[model samples]
Target: MQRPDDVRWPVRVARAVLHAQATGTLIAQYGLVERAWPAALPAVPATRLGVQANCLTDVGVRGMDEAAVFLAEHLKLQGLPEAGEPVERLSAGGWAARHAAGEHSDADFCAVIDAQACFAGAWATARELVSAVLESGGPPRSPGALLYAAVVAGGEANPPVPAAELFALAGKAAAREADALLVDLRLAAYTLKRLSHPPGALGRLAGLVRGTGDAERRHALSPADAATVRALAMNLEALALLKKAAAAVRTLEDNLAENRAGHPESVGETLSIAAYFHYREQDLTRALELIAEAYRLVRRDGAPDRLRGCRKIAVAALHCGGRTAEAEQVQLRMARDPLGFDEEIR
Candidate 1:
């Protein structure tokens, strides 16, 4: 089948590879290669090599004849002198070695490393790469690299630099890259993590969330305003402001109702957040109602990880509502199908 020309296809493939790496499942990794490899064959050299390198690193060439064939084809396309060598004998590390020998662009290398760091929990390497990139930079070289740096710096363990400074740096990159919404969301998340019970911190997070919502409305983007609102509500809950948190959740629900068509995943996530808030408030009935809706949406249209999360919430609500047997059944289903592919719960 002929694949459509999509300039962003390489990035999507890279993300799938990263997700496979995070899941650490051979099924996920093989599924990505089978689906993405053919489509990516027609991409540009840099993109193709980047995607190939990421796949090879995450899923070794062992037992995968298709991977070997594609590697040879990609090398030939790139005019690499060693194209005829038996790829079956080459380890995944060999691909990295080739890239390090100047076959791939620095951007691709950094991007792959950033993916590993971001998704695969290679934080030490990510911190090092980000520091090197920033120290040698003129302007923000990569928005994603900077964002990863900010996330690493904001983590609980001792940061390489102050989280605030890294976040500010990331903000600059976001402005240049036109990714302000993502930066705002990260900043809001950081605030929630760092602040214990300060009203001022919560107020700042609310402002960030509000600003993100305004920007989304102006651009007619997918109404991720619900997510920001939900984050703000979570911070309110952290501060023991239950009523205010409930109000924020209501706003989240309203946003979902208003823009349900743009992104079903976001709607599902917003509903799940609301259910958790209701669960915390001891409104088990309401919590179950919201979570059931979320489960149905995610089961039909969301990723396995999302379905798993929604199921967890359902279990919590059921267990708290004195339905221990039903909760156990759900728990058993969850354990049996970690991917959340089972039929709908009764």
Candidate 2:
């Protein structure tokens, strides 16, 4: 089918391919994609579209022939290409066949459509991941890793492709996909905390509080999970509030004493929170100080996760604070996982 004008399927396709790896659990976790399809695509199913609606259900996940039929019909309606012709056929094999037979004379059109299918597949994968992570129950694996997997898959799926010259070839997609992407990020943060408790738990709590405005469901957790849920929520609020107060001191410089007093901490987390604030404000010096204090406190307390988190903040603070030499040295010994870079980490 011809892509929508506003969708930009080329980019979407790239992102989808990158995110497909994490889709299985994401789909099972989330249960369903927030808003699956647009109103215009009546032919597309919310729960099932024969085999074409791979994102909705596993109705035809294994039937490529059925998928081809749907594609052929979609192509016929769009009038962009057809099944037997190189431009019209719907399979990876068909694409090869057309290319080999010289039936697809327009290389540009062939490239665009193939890219769209690949992206659609990736998007399907992400949706699947979201659904999986949110599901009520599953294996005992940490939720954080699943979430990280989703982000990793997502970033990998949509690697930037320089296609400014081929603007017309970009197939547009529904805004729902972008919305879905953000939701996935939020979910990733929640899952990450699940992987590692207390601090990771704290981060997840913070996310829930900050993300309340954008939550898809009013009641995401069950009544039985109340204690855990409250812990997650409160932890996020505390961290976020502490971070904000610290930022006020650095940026406004007027709120330092006031924020610090309100965010009193006997443990070293207060310092870490301060560092978080300064880092956001770009006040690397102050951030480094707080991070150091936090690291010391965490080490004494014997909470490796919190300690590791503080160390990470310290490294980043040093790097941004113009202590490039120190930051480089610190980076060499750190765990250095890319999962930390996921948008949800914000």
Candidate 3:
């Protein structure tokens, strides 16, 4: 199949983001090696977590296409043999085979993992892949990558390892390969993210926050790193005390231009956070406006989940604002649009 031009950069990025997240979820649910290497991921203690392959059904086959594109793009960007490339596909069986061939360097691995970790959906599966990578014997090509994989792996394993413990382990293992301070800072960022979400690792996040600010303030992150930090912050908002989470959201918005130039996903996230906050505060009018903004962005980009979320919020906001006619129209349109009715994508 022919690939679309990148002229639609924002939509492409958003699609890529969605694809990566969905792929991660698939890995977490079904176990990455389950179909191919049934005993692999499951044999690991972390396999105790049930990762239903069925979850991908909702995201649909496009999710897999996006995943393939993501891996292909990463491989090309890293100068590794992309499995999707005809010659490379024959040689590597595809991108995964090329990756397994040890042709990738530390920087290559770092770039891949960094891109992979940007989505929440990818968190669990990425963690498993990283853990397995850590146990793989080699002179440790990429310490930063190793540290990242270790942190993610620890998050899903049966024992449910603490980010801190993983941080320490990563520090000890990768210290000689990279600067301990840098490693610590990166570790701190992921720790903060893990704490900010459903499982709520507040204590760890709190401990990491102070020192992380010190390090990050002094260092400039790559554009990709900036995006990852923002995504992590979004996840963090849920786990943080309301006040702190609110403040973080504000900071994320303040720094929007840094990450938003060509990335609608980041922008949509900002809008979603703003909308969610306003909704919770009962400022339904403002929430409605922001949700509308979010819907506009996602709809243009083919991101159904964002649109669905915005639609739900907008309906509530319209009701609060007593704009019954507009609310009804929105509902009617939603019911009529086949794309809008994809509850699975929602």
Measured against the true structure, the TM-scores of the candidates, in listed sequence, are: 0.58, 0.27, 0.46
Q: Write candidate 2's Cα lDDT for 129-226 as tens digits.
A: 22332242321132222322233233322323211111111112113322332333333333333232335534544554444433324454333233
Candidate 2 local accuracy as lDDT? 0.36
Please state the error at residue 112 of candidate 3 in Å.
Answer: 6.6
Sort the predicted structures by lDDT, highest score first.
1, 3, 2
Candidate 1: deviation at residue 263, Å? 4.1
In terms of TM-score, how similar is model 3 to the real structure? 0.46
Which ranges in model 3 have alpha carbons more than 4 Å from their true place? 1-128, 139-141, 147-209, 212-239, 243-267, 298-303, 322-325, 328-346
Model 1: lDDT of residue 83: 19
Among residues 3 or more apart in sequence or in different chains, the pairs in candidate 1 whose N, CA or C atoms overlap within 3 Å are: none
lDDT of 1 at 157: 34
lDDT of 1 at 134: 47
- Report the C-alpha lDDT of model 3 over 123-192, residue by residue, as the tens digit: 4444434444444443234555545544444343242435466556657765432244334544444444
lDDT of 1 by residue, 1-346 (tens): 0113222223344444434445553243223343343322322133432223332221110111233233223323332222121212222243244444545444554454433332233344444444444444322345554555566556543465565666666677664322554465455555555533346555765765566666666764445545544443443334334446667556555655644655453566667767877787788888888888887766553234556677788898898889999999888887665434566753
Best by TM-score: 1
- Model 2 poorest 10 in a row by lDDT: 162-171
Question: lDDT per model, in order?
Answer: 0.49, 0.36, 0.43
